[model samples]
Target: LNPEARAFDASFEVLSVEEAVRVTGRYAPLADAVRELIEATILTEVDGGVVDNARAAIEGVTESLRQRTRSAKVSYRVDGRPLPLGNAAVGVCNPIAPPIVVHQEGGGRCWSEFVLGLAYEGPPGLVHGGVSALVLDHMLGEAASEGLSKARFTGTITVKYLRGTPLGPLRSEAWIERHEGVKVFARGTISDAAGVTVEADGVFIEPAWARDGQ
Candidate 1:
């Protein structure tokens, strides 16, 4: 490949098809679970009927996923916070959305924030590497799922740990890089009083099934 092409490819942080397949397998169940919530809510007596059903479905899926996948999780929507789960990043953040806010997009791009707690320890008083990755993944994933771009799961994510994250308050941010066909590309990072501890790049897929308008 030419230097320009190589630079573009290098900039992408692309993954192999096999790698994409593997990630799809890992996250497909989560997507399906969300669909189930949408289906089940069809019969619920929501106030706005259609829109209310959609909200219930979204909230239900987030709650269900939080319960099953999160370790120690706490979440809140417009309503209020719910029972906390263990080891959950959102649960730890104390501001995570229950119906899993896809996309840090409350209003627009550039989503960011921080957290500090006892559980996310690594070196002395630093946050753990895995914990940093988890937070970045969810933040990136949220941006992916945002209505602006219909990204499903991360096809690939590359993270760099530039420094040790402090155990105190931390900040995180995620935003869309671009979109190609059914793929939505995004980037995110986590930082703290010390500095930028982690940087992340992600490719999110809209999924084959989602194309059917599901």
Candidate 2:
């Protein structure tokens, strides 16, 4: 089986897909509310009293959450099946993760469609350069691993900014160019309706732990 399909099948052994969806569904609304709060914090022009009240309300929620025991793992999961909760780019349960879902596009390609809001603004209405890099890095790494078929981490990545990436709807695509031994080389681009605004190339390598397992 292809790497991606194998990974999916493996997930079922730990947590059925239906249960995974149910768990994530519970967290999704909370994450969305926090995401909206981020945008409102960036764009809202309310009075000081309103801001103070909002702060107090948020602090109360934070304190309540803190009272609960925290999980040791950085990422959330159901049994051994990993969830993208803490992922910075496309995590549905990560409030700070941009509103994007990266999906495989057959072959070794991966694609994402997303929109950046005021919370991600940089350079007066443009998406932050660092954010672009984060997304590209994630996409390139996904392609390199064939959507997590094999465990890999980025060894090197080079991004070239062709133009300003606007703070709105955008498209990202990445594909594996080739693989050599434990190394995979990939290329990717971020584009708006006008055209490509950022392009990147990266090399990903299997870590020692993963290689040893093989």
Candidate 3:
């Protein structure tokens, strides 16, 4: 890590990350708004001409931005982790993320929260099964590496869909169950207002670089 990125105090790092999160998070609502419009258009009785015009307008804007950013990709690192500015998925700071937006609520478990919407829908009004797995995967991996200096990668994960995950506010959690050599055992679940919907178990492995003290 460069000295400049590492020099900030822990408190300053936290605040800086928070500011970045807030600033980058502003785009999420815009994406969400567009998502809602898409869903509405799917069922709307509006004429085809109007829809075509709207689509063209949106495409023009997208193209303009793409051209403006024709340069090479920009990346930032903080506290040894990659910055999440333009991550298409799993980036809480990215507007386009379906963002499971996990937070460490306490010591024993890793908890995350998000509300599924049309953009993540499958099976008509229900959260997609694959999306559920994606959330659990990330939460479980984080749990497996909790309090460790090294990061863990998913070796294998098994998920059981207990019930249909509804499209609304939901929470997921994971905790380390045990460890065997380089592998960490973990379990996690997704829950809605009704109750637990999806459960998962996985083995997460400390990657080679981290284990080698990189």
Candidate 4:
């Protein structure tokens, strides 16, 4: 393990990789079901009765789950260790997250492949610009962390949308460009079969907490 990563881990409650997988896996199906429901709600034209029935069922489930809500968020391993189950971008248990699975390639690079359904649609079958930015931001931060071998937070990110990103299968790639002191600079792109549609550059900074631990 990278020394920096190990040091950072010392500051948080670390769970066994198996436990993380099991916990995330337990929720994975629920997330997928919700994703399907979202897409279906957007695309399907149902009667008022059907809509009311669905709404009532969902409300019941929500109330039941609310009874078991945690009082505080747990600080668990995120940066490619086990799984970031609560992450908004790449969490398997997050229903709102696109189906993005990030893979760390050699030489400070990270890649993700995913598909966007109707729930992410904007501008008539195209992906929203903000959604593109969100994906790039997370990808660039992952690259920065991989480059520095430590967790990093987004300092600033600039995204350029070259063309309309269609709502469907897409790929993103990010890599570290350089680092200075506690900041890592990274670049990334979202591409389709034709070519790149979005590009981004970002600076990631080591948080004060992690730096203090070091």
Residue-level lDDT of model 1, residues 2-93, one tens digit each, is: 23224324222244556545644566455445435544554466567787667777788677767654222222122221212121444322
On the 0 to 100 scale, the lDDT of residue 69 in model 3 is 46
lDDT of each: 0.59, 0.83, 0.72, 0.82
**Candidate 4: segments with Cα more than 4 A from true spot:** 1-12, 78-82, 147-149
Give lDDT tens digits, candidate 4, residues 1-214. Answer: 4455465453344777787778777888889998998888878788999999999999999898788754244446644453566567887878999858888897779998899877877799899898899999989988998833576989999999999999899999999999899998999999998999999999999876577764
Clashes of 1: 16
TM-score of each: 0.52, 0.88, 0.78, 0.88
Query: Any residue pairs clashing in model 3, and if so which?
Result: 28-95
lDDT of 2 at 117: 86
Q: Tell how far residue 117 is off in model 3, in angstroms.
A: 1.3
Better of 2 and 3 by TM-score: 2
lDDT tens digits by residue: candidate 2, 1-214: 3343343343222456787788678878889999999988988999999999999999999898788653543334464445666678878878999857879977789999999988888899999999999999999988887776667789999999999999999999999999899898999999999999999999998876566642
lDDT of 3 at 75: 53
C-alpha RMSD between model 4 and the true structure: 3.9
Lowest lDDT sum, 10 consecutive residues, model 2, at 4-13
Residue-level lDDT tens digits of model 3 in 108-190: 36787777777678898899998888888878877786723346788999999998999889988899898899999999999
